[model samples]
Target chain A: MSIELEIQLVAVVVSVACSLAGVFLVLRRMALMSDAISHTVLLGIVLVFFITRDIASPFLVLGAAAMGVATVGLVEALVRTRLVREDASIGLVFPALFSIAVILITRYAGSVHLDTDAVLLGEIAFAPFRRLEVGGVDLGPRSLWVMGGVLLLNITFIALLYKELKLSTFDPGLAAALGFAPGLLHYAFMTLVSITAVGAFDAVGSILVVALMITPPATAYLLSDSLPRVLILSAVIAALAALVGFWTAWLVDASIAGCMASAAGVLFLLAFLLAPERGVIAVARRRSRQRWEFARLMLAIHLLHHEGAPDAANESRETHLGEHLRWEPKFARRVVSEAADEDLLVRLQDGRLELTETGRDSARKAMLV
Target chain B: MNPLRDLLFDYTLRTVALGAGTLGIVAGALGTYAVLRRQSLLGDAISHAALPGIVLAFILTGMKSTLVLVLGAALAGWLGTLVVMMIVRHSRLPEDSALGIVLSVFFGAGLVLLTYVQKLPDASQAGLDSFLFGQAATMLERDVVVIAVLGAIALLAVVVFWKEFKILSFDPEFGASLGMPMRSIDILLTTFLVIAIVIGLQTVGVVLMSAMVIAPAAAARQWTNSLSVMVLLSALFGAMAGVTGALISSTAQHVPTGPTIVLCATVLVLISMAFAPERGLIWAAVQRRQQRRQIRADAVLGDLYALAGHHESEHAHDVTVLEAMRAGRTDVHRALDILEERGLARRDGTGGWTITRAGRAEAEQAGESGPDGQHEREGSA
Candidate 1:
């Protein structure tokens, strides 16, 4: 495969794996945990490299995953103290660990080629150079193989534990009562998140890992309510973002991971503005429609209230609709006309308004509710 | 003494350390409020969001002055926060999700701009990436002056609105009932926080700036309960970390000043959590242990008091009978030895213990103190 193809493949696999875990993270309200994990995992890799003196050790992955879990664990411990909140705990844990890693790199491992810059802005372009070979057969880019394996692991975990994950995410108490052990499931899921973050770290870097993980799942969440649909939509969105981000990077010759993240963000914004049910436009339309219906109900109720009272004629006159109801003339006219068209009001021969039987029944029901 | 004077008065080191110290104090003061309001992550978001603004400012003006870049960063941070507020108000997403989204998206945009700028014709643009990880060693006297000025403004704002900001952090509803402009106070506080984050960008950088804002305040929180004391201590701790980290990093080879300062702050946090007088873990553990010992002594004293009720002549109780009174306790002898040491009881040389005159007085004290024991347990730790 071409190097460009390999980069895109790596991006796709990384995004899909991250988004899959991102779905659960967003659902469980642990979106920032990925950010924390992505950062502190740098410390893990550095520590492991110091021990093995080689960057190609599998111990690095193991160490990164361990550090990810350690980050979550330490944050939880701090939060449990009730002295600090979750967000503050997160902010405290990762920076301390990441800074330690950075300091260690500058102090002990300066002779090594472990640059902090690479951890932040990963050179996916270099992925093509780090070829994976097995039995003298070239297996394309190493990042592609590593990310592909991680993707398979994620798919297998999600598929096998779909129901458990859904139940735990939606309602943990019920899951626990059903013997699912939500706490155990949570940590297990975090471990998977850590592993996936490690795999994506080299391809997209840490911050973009967070962007790809969160943005796609969040957009998918805005688009769908069902867990299945959300999962599927998130993967599709991530894949599309990967492809588009690659092309944009190619066009602009900028940071490929950054462009991919930008593409994912763009997709999220589009969904935010245009999703069918939950989009901003849809919400505004529904609210305004409800307001109009409410005004019409008020008109019906007002006429019903003055049906036989003294000064009922003056109050019910269409000309007095704005004055008595305290509405704008145009607004009053619109409500009255719409009500008439809906057969909820009638113009009396004496030049006063009255509610039809259906209108009166509906008005009483609205008031009762 | 010569070495100390040289370290303190050295021009280059003094500039870097003084600049970091100023940034530390401002961030510390503002961070106390941020941590109290549970808006600590807001600092993180604003710092990341400031990146695009920083890049855009360089692109627009092509000037790398501290003031221009800081102004750009403050504007960007403020705009990002405004967007965050808008998202929270208008969307279904929660605050953390909104914060994460704005933070990542803006930083990505900044990265895109940064890469573009790196390829531009101007070599001065190369310094822009340093704003990410920070290069405290390169701070100029002019940069120090900028930080000092901005830091003074933020500090002045905090002092001028102390009562109002305090009430806003603790209770906005009450402040509103007093006819104060709650919204304006909120905006003013956020503006100060943004300035605080922006000023530190040159030294701590965007990635670790939030740590500077958070760690000092958090470490100070472990030592005090009053807001005023917390703020003061936070500023002190921040300045200490700043000066110490800068000094150490300058002396050490290859160590970056930002992370070293953060590491120093973390060290303070660890020490405070473990050993602070009132709220520290060691204190809590010690208090728990002492309470357990006092309860055991009281039980044994009470047991002896009961055994004395059946005595006619000597008021001596057998050890076996005392053990039977508090059944299943293997530590009964040890309890007796503690009481004996306190002059509350004495061994009668026949595997029995006699309650002394002082022991009888203490038993009565323990008898009358039963209800207060509940209060003491409630108040101890």
Candidate 2:
């Protein structure tokens, strides 16, 4: 395969894996923890490398996974003490560990190939050069296989624990009561997150890993309400982002990981503005719609309140709506037209609004609710 | 010569250490508000978000001056924070997600700009990358002066608005209800934080900058319960970390200055967590042990009083009955030892134990205040 193809494959697979885990993180309100894990995982890699003197040792993966879980564990411990909040705990734990790793690398391992820059902005272009050989056969980029394996592991973990994850994420107390051991599940999920984050680092840097993990799932959440739909949509969004981001990087001749994150960011912005249910536009539309309906109900209830009074005629007049409810003439006209369209109000021969039976019932119900 | 005297004499080392110290004090002060408000992660986001601004400033002006770069970073960090606040307030998405989005997107943009800058003809772009991991040794006297000036202004703002900031941090709603311009205070506080973070970016860099903002405040939090004391201690701890880290990293070859300073702050946190009075883990454990001993002794005395009441006589009873009441005899034995020390119970020297007149009176007192004991147990647990 061509180097470009290899890089694209790595980007897509890694993005999808991250998005899969990200969906649960977003749902559980632990999105920032992913950022923390991505960073502190560097410490695990550095620690393992320090001992083994081999960057490719499988032990690095184990160490990275342990470190990821440790990050969550330490954060939880801090929060349990009630001295710090969740975000504060996250901010406290990761930097300490990451700084230690950085110190170790720059001080003790200065002669080694590892450095902080590579860790921060991983080069996918160079990822194509590091090929895995099997029995003297050229097998393309090594990152592809590693990322592909992690992606597979992520899928299997999610697939097997989907029900448990959904249950525990939404109602952990109930899940615990039902013997699912939500705490254990939380640790297992965090472990997967750590492993995936470390694997993706070679293709996309740590920041982009956080981006793909959070942005795609968060975008999908804006678009979909169902868990399964959100999961599938997030994966699809991640894959598309990977492709577009790769091409943009290619065109600009810049960092592929940065471009991917930019692309994901652009996609999230689109979803934020245009998604069907929870998007900004949708929410604004809903609020406006509710406002109009509320005005109409107020009109109906006002007319009903003055039905038999001496000033009922004046109160029910179309001209009085502007003064009675203190609405603009244009706004009142729009509300009247909308009410007429909904058949909630009738205009009498006297040019005054009288609520139809349906309108009266709706106003009563709106007030009751 | 003393190390302090030696430090003051080394011109380069003195500049770097003083710069770090100033940066630390400013961050620690603002970070007290951030931590109290539970917005510690906002510092992390703003620091990461400053990268694009730094790169853009360099690209636009083609200058590598610390003041210009710091200004650019401050603007970008504030812009990113504004967007996060907008997203959180305007959308259904939570603050954490908004923070994450801004952090990554701004950082990603920064990376692209950085790479683009690197390819430009300007060879001076080398210093820009140092803003990522930070090279404190490269800090110039001009940069230190800028940091000190800004640090002093930020610290002054914190002092001037101490009461308002305290109210805003603890309960903004109450402040707002009292007709205070809470929203303005919040923005002002955030501005202080952004400025503090931007100036420190040169010394601590984007990655470890938030650590400087949060670590000292968190460590000092363990040491004190009062807000004013906490803030003062946090600044002290931050300055100590900064100076100590600069000294140690300078003495040791190959150790980066920023992370070393952060590690010193973390060590302070570890010490505070382990040894701080009242709130420390060890202290809490010791308190728990003492309470457990007291409860066990109370239970043993209560049992001996019951034995005296059951017999309708003031006679000694077999100590085996008390031992049999508990599954573990160690608790019973230890409780007996405490009871004897308090003159509440005594062994008859034939494997028998009897309640003293003082013991009966003590048990009666405990019975009268038994409800409070239950409440105390619950509170302790």
lDDT of 2 by residue, A39-128 (tens): 988899998998899977999988988999999999999889876678788998998888898888887787777878888888787888
Predictions' DockQ, in order: 0.66, 0.66
Query: On residues B1-381, what C-alpha lDDT tens digit does candidate 1 reach at each position?
Result: 243475678888888889989898999999999999988889998999999999999999999999999999999999989878877777777777778787888888888889999999998887798898788889999999999999999999999999999999999999999999998999899999999999999888898899888889998999999999999999999998888888888877788888888888889888888888878888878988766766676687788887787776366777788788778564678878888888988988676788888988877875677768645643652
| TM, every model | 0.94, 0.91
lDDT (tens digit, per residue) of candidate 1 on A1-369: 788888888889999999999999888888888889999999999999989999899999999999999999999999987667888899899989999998888788877778877888888879889988999998788888889999999999999999999999888989999999888888998999999999998888888889888889988988998999999999999999999989999999988888888899899889988998988988999999999999999999998888899989899987898788889888988998999999998988997888899999988998894
i-RMSD per candidate, Å: 1.1, 1.2
Clashing pairs in 1: none
DockQ for candidate 2, C-alpha atoms: 0.66
lDDT score at residue A23, model 2, on the 0-100 scale: 94
TM-score of chain A of each: 0.94, 0.91
